[model samples]
Target: MTIEVNNESGLEIDERAVLDIARYALARMRIHPLSELSVIAVDIPAMEQLHLQWMDLPGPTDVMSFPMDELRPPSRDDEEPPPGLLGDIVLCPQVARTQGAEAPTAHSMDTELQLLTVHGVLHLLGYDHEEPDERTEMFGLQKAIVDGWRTEQGLEGPSPAPTMT
Candidate 1:
């Protein structure tokens, strides 16, 4: 997969980790190996503008996904998905740090970013948490993917999963 990461967040982020987690999630979810994805880490003001423009919300959100070709994760028995533009995942490190500090487990900004990376990838793959059932499924899958990636990376298990409101 062609995964490009650009950090304009003004915060010193571990861009490699973000890219790794995104790639891991895409591979785990069985996306086409030739697919393309872009991840941008933006500053608070940029994120806020995007939030208002795209979602009509007032504040900077932790992460926002703008899917391009609308790729979907293939089932285990299904053939691999065709290569396409999987789209952009915009991450706000400032917001992630604040949220991480506020979490019950008090996760590091890196961990939070990694989790959000996976969450954004899921959104690109057509997983959503708009309804109760969808929330459960999406969050559960998100947790599993992050935790699994952490375990493979020789890192500690994941912190609590983020709730989508």
Candidate 2:
């Protein structure tokens, strides 16, 4: 998969880690290798504007997903899946930092961003958390992906209930 990470948040962030996490999430989800994805980090103002325009929310949220082709994971009975644009994952590091500070589990800003990146990618892959069942499934998958990635990277696993806000 073509994973592009653009850091325009004006805050110092590990762009490489963001790209790696995104790639790992896509790979774990069994997405096509030729699928294209973009991860953009913007300032709070930019995020707020996007939130208002897209989600109709008042302030900047942690992350927002703008899907393009609405690609779904291929099943075992399916043939080779077609390549397509996966979509864009917009992130607000400032919001992540604030949320991280208030989160029950102590986590660094980088960790928060990583979580948000994975969550956003899941959303791009057609995951939603609006309903109780959907939230359970989405959050479960998200935690699994993140924990697996952390294990692969030799990092410590987060709390059993990592904050998803």
Candidate 3:
């Protein structure tokens, strides 16, 4: 997979970790090896503009996914999914930092960003949490992927569990 990260958030973040986690999530989802994805980190103002324009929300959120080809994970009996543009995941590091600070768990902004990265990946692959059942499935899968990545990286911190609220 081709995962490109552009950090324009004017904040220092582990862009490599974001890239790694996004790639890891795609791999876990069994996306095509030739699939392409873009992870862009923007400032609060830019994120707010996007939020208002795309989602019609009032403020900047942690992450927003804009899928292109609308790809889904291939079933076990199906062939590998075709290569396509998986889409863009816009991240706001400033917002993420604030969220991390507010979370019950004590963890770094990087960990929060990593979790958002995986969540964005899932959204690009047609995962959502608008409904209760959707929330359960999407958040559960997201937690599992993030925990697995953290374990593989030998990272030590809280599990970054979903808020579940």
Which candidate number has the best lDDT?
1
The TM-score of candidate 2 is 0.94
Error of 3 at 105 (Å): 0.6
Clashing pairs in 2: none
Clashing pairs in 1: none
Ordering by lDDT: 1, 3, 2
Residues 107-145, candidate 1: write the lDDT tens digits.
878788988999999998999999999999999999888
**Better TM-score candidate (1, 2):** 1
Error of 1 at 160 (Å): 3.1
Which residue runs does candidate 2 get wrong by more than 4 Å?
77-79, 159-162
Worst 10-residue stretch by lDDT in candidate 1? 156-165
lDDT by residue (1-165, candidate 2, tens digit) is: 899999999999989889999999998988989999999999999999999998888988899999999997777746676789999999899988887788877677788899999999889989999899999999999999989989999997652354664
Stretches > 4 Å off in candidate 1:
none
lDDT per residue, candidate 3, 68-142, as tens digits?
999999988467689999999999998888877778885677778998999999999999999989998999899
Query: For model 1, what is the error of residue 83's alpha carbon versus the real structure, in angstroms, after optimal superposition?
Result: 0.6
Best by TM-score: 1
